[model samples]
Target: MTMVSDLFNSREIALGVWLMIAIIAVLFGKSTRSGFGGVLKALFVWNLMSWLAGMAVYISAFIYLFYRIGLWTPDLLKDTVFYILFSATVSMFKANKISEDKHFFLEMLKDNLKAGILLEFLIGQYTFDLWVELLIVPAAVLLAGMQAFAANDAKYAAVNKLINSIWFISGGFVIYHVVDSVIQHFHELLSLGVLRQILLVPNLTLVFIPFLYVLSLRMVYEEQFIMLSFKLRDKKLLRFSKRQAILKFNTDLRGLKRWVNRWNLSHPQTREEILVTIDAFKTQQYLEKAPPVVLPQQGWSPYVAKDWLPDEKLKPAFYDPAYEEKWSARSGNLKLDKDWSGNGITYSVTGTRLAADHLELRLAAYESKKLDELHAIFKERVALLYKNATGVEAPLKLTNAISRKKNIHFRQGIYFISLEKSIWGNITEGYDLIFTISTKND
Candidate 1:
């Protein structure tokens, strides 16, 4: 068996080749078969260009850095321009669209490739760095995975037809893509009568390519996954905090209503004034389940499962790991947790839609305290990351841009809350809670 050092080192060709195949298998799953054939064809032109440029860069950069400071060769120019082009292209894609999908294409090639689905794939082939060559096998498989997983909301979901074909034909070995890439280089060097040491450089580079690519992509993938998880968790916590805050504000309405009732009782003739307060607080509001999200919730799949949490309370005795629940409750019909006196709102599957993607409420008769509580909770989330209003520099009036659609109103607490969650999406459904929070008639 190869030693562990041999496995990690890029210096060995066999190790590198084995690593490449292994990584490709992980990234593509079943798509490394015939699907790769199509990918190879599309990538053929790009690979030829990359080979021309990268070889030139390697030679030129090596020479310049070690020896000549002047006499820039055509290879230098080719490599420099290619690097600039690729960097610019990658930056443009990143800035152009916010990739909302949490799952990465892992494309190191396609956004789920058949030939080309996204324009970025076509652009990437022409513009990416030659170092990407090492990642070719893995990304090719990832492309298949991306095609498979892009639309899937679940873990390890099935891919569509075109991708299946790619998967079918992509299996067996790493030799095909490697051989395809290097055949010309090998042939050219033999014809040129290059020295033995120099001739092997390209092959050496090829060996190291997969190792480097996998390492780099793995780093990026991990960083991205961590960051994405943080944002999602932050958003959820921000919302939860909002719910807790509502309890505090609920008390305010109670005190106000009591004063109003007392005033009306003392005058007995000031009935109209008391009536106005009641009308405002007791008004019935209805929110029908947003048609788009008219489905039930399933559940969020967070990394820290419920079983992992410690049973005892947190203490200053030791640092505790951050906790996250894939779920929570609000006592409204269509709210993320509850539906009140109405049809309530529900978020769509994508969790992108706003306006209707919220639970509705009805603030009817003496429920001002509950309304205040709800509003207060909403306010907290709004203040925090929801509107992103509270932190750092103030943003424009785009507060609603990020707020979880927490649609609420009043007809008392019997409102319908529909929760097609903004992040987890209909992961919590089939439960209901109704409660009456007594408030002094204001």
Candidate 2:
């Protein structure tokens, strides 16, 4: 209570409190992966220098403005002192070591002068009662909350516009009252001397208040990010299902990305590494839950007999005449397609004849299974079919498919097989087995 009273009653006390706030803001306002030491350097080294430079720029602007307005006599040293203190407060609050802009201080000065002029010159004159002054704080906070919600959620745009109008109108009334008091008592207020002017407080405190509010808001978001990071690091799967964990991780990652963009921080390699680890973990979990792989039966080939012909040996149940017109329109080739069921699994078969001696066959199986498991199963099927057709062992390995990262290709004599996984929209949907047999060059 005593300190709060001193803050309003003594300019020195108020200035000291503002300085302490600035120091605290500098100490914790950065996104540092280097821990405590990095925060200390930000406060005492890089940010300190930036704040000092910004302060010098703002103070110069304030002094030049005062001189241009004919209010810069020797007796106005008190006003100059207040301006210096005010500039230091603003500079410390706005300083950023990593992403500071060269024009930031100039922009800050322009904005401050514009705000002051709008409040003092354009608003005319008015006054408010003590009760009204007390009500303004809660009213402003409520309106601010509405504005924040409206900004984030598009459904509240009309409400946001209304809130903005209310703020502008209320601001004009407050400004008129403040400017009126200053104008009507200008000479008598000047006579109160430096100490009294300092005690009464300039509009500097108003400027300082907004900075404090913004700093506090930033701190709140930083604390939220820290909490989210900790949640991501926790390894208890029992608390959250794999899907829930993934959703939460994605949401937190998006929040972190927004924070990084807003602060203009460098790309976070640590977070990327964490994301990779999480993806590997999720993949492992998915593989553990997937059904066992089943290879195709021995000597069972998607081809009809050993000859590549669409009309000669293809069963009527596995032939679609509709594909002939479709394929011929696109590539001048005759094609056939049908869904073939064997071993309780359905395979989509497509055969296209490029020439009398050349044929392309594709067999695709769709299943909701882990990507790695599906690849393993299809690789074995392709190898088996290739060896049965050519009487030679297919040179295939899991590494061959996995390391190739998308598709695998193997050729033996006139028979060539290419294996690939199916990607439906954004996800790995299934696997494909493609065989091309050409006797033209044989």
Candidate 3:
């Protein structure tokens, strides 16, 4: 019969056209660049989804047209474009849209819901393929949920974990039961009038779920993204606090010469001020050597703070003048008294072992407010280098600066160039130096 031949011819043309399109896509979709792999992969997924959807939409439309007209003949271009539009509509529904984006999609969801419902109403329509469109929202939600979990921290983590867990558990059991037991009950109900039963309340309910679920998840995901951003900002301030303290200590130290020159040590309040400054600048308190607060009942981790320190005192360095005196006094030999640096600028921390225990230090004199700062800057840079250096191949040279906003400082009145014979032993006197370099006016 003519109807049968026409059906066969139409199907052949559709198949041949699809094959040709596939060849064209394969040729154009590939790339020559190395970094284009991700682009190609995304394109591949998009096209593959479009291709499958196109074929289904065209075939279903053709069959319905044939039954109505008693013959089949599909225009390749017309059918392909229509199917592609339908596929795009399906893809758009589940795409996660931000608040700024939702205005565009609000109209799209309305259009698709109309098309989906109307397609099922046609008597010979083979549009269970339209139900595939329903999958987009749920898939997007599941994906958005996963992204939320991957990057989650304190606050939103609890809710994100709960939704994903509960959804998986509930959906798995519910969907499986619907397929196994409810399918039979629905089948019996639908046997009377399959088309009407399929298109009505159940399908609307099913379609609505995926749509609402994705939209709700996207909203929560957006809110949490904002909260996480704020938390990271707070964490940034916490980290900056340590760096700020170091900079402040360095700045005050650079002012040493000014303070040393101006200090009225003969004043009535001199001793009391010196005592307070010394206590504040003590090595055990200044450095992390101060015992962390510990809960003895629950032993140690990194969090112990404000722990009590015992026997706080300074230890001698390799070149200490005290050792020369102690050695000379022991034997009946000629002893040389080494002269001290200007204004007693010494600082030394005493500990039996390198780390994993208490640290203590003594400064030359914590008398002048300006001079006391030298002890801080010297200890900060010196102690850091010492702790981190393990048997160095070469001697470590560390620089510390005391900064003034608009000026460079050398703490001592003069930069004494000539002293000891060797460069290592040169520069016996300490001096102030500015750390930061600024502009012309600066």
TM-scores, all models, native as reference? 0.21, 0.29, 0.21
lDDT of 2: 0.44
Better model by TM-score: candidate 1 vs candidate 2: 2
In model 2, the runs with Cα more than 4 Å from the true position are 1-86, 92-102, 112-131, 175-424, 427-442
The model with the greater TM-score, 2 or 3, is 2
Minimal lDDT window, size 10, model 3: 327-336
lDDT for each candidate structure: 0.33, 0.44, 0.35
Model with the higher lDDT, candidate 1 or 2? 2
Query: Which tens-of-lDDT digit does each residue in 1-442 have in candidate 3?
Result: 4664344333334444555765676666645343355657765686446644654554456446543654323333343344344443444444444233345445645654565553333321221222342453355567677757654445667676776787688656545644554445654545424443333333323344344444434444444334334433455542342233233333232222222222232121333443343343343233334444533222221112111111111112121112311110011111112222332322222112112211212233222334545545433533442332211221222222122212222211111111111112233433332121111111
- Against the true structure, candidate 3 reaches a TM-score of 0.21
Clashes of each: 56, 0, 10
Question: Cα lDDT for residue 86, model 3?
Answer: 49
Q: How high is the lDDT of residue 239 in model 3?
A: 39
Q: Specify the highest-TM-score model's number.
A: 2
Residue 235 miss distance in model 2 (angstroms): 42
Tens-digit lDDT track of model 1 for 262-372: 332233223343344334333211111112222222211111111111221110111111223111112222232332423232111111111111221122212222344
List the candidate numbers ranked by TM-score, top first.
2, 3, 1
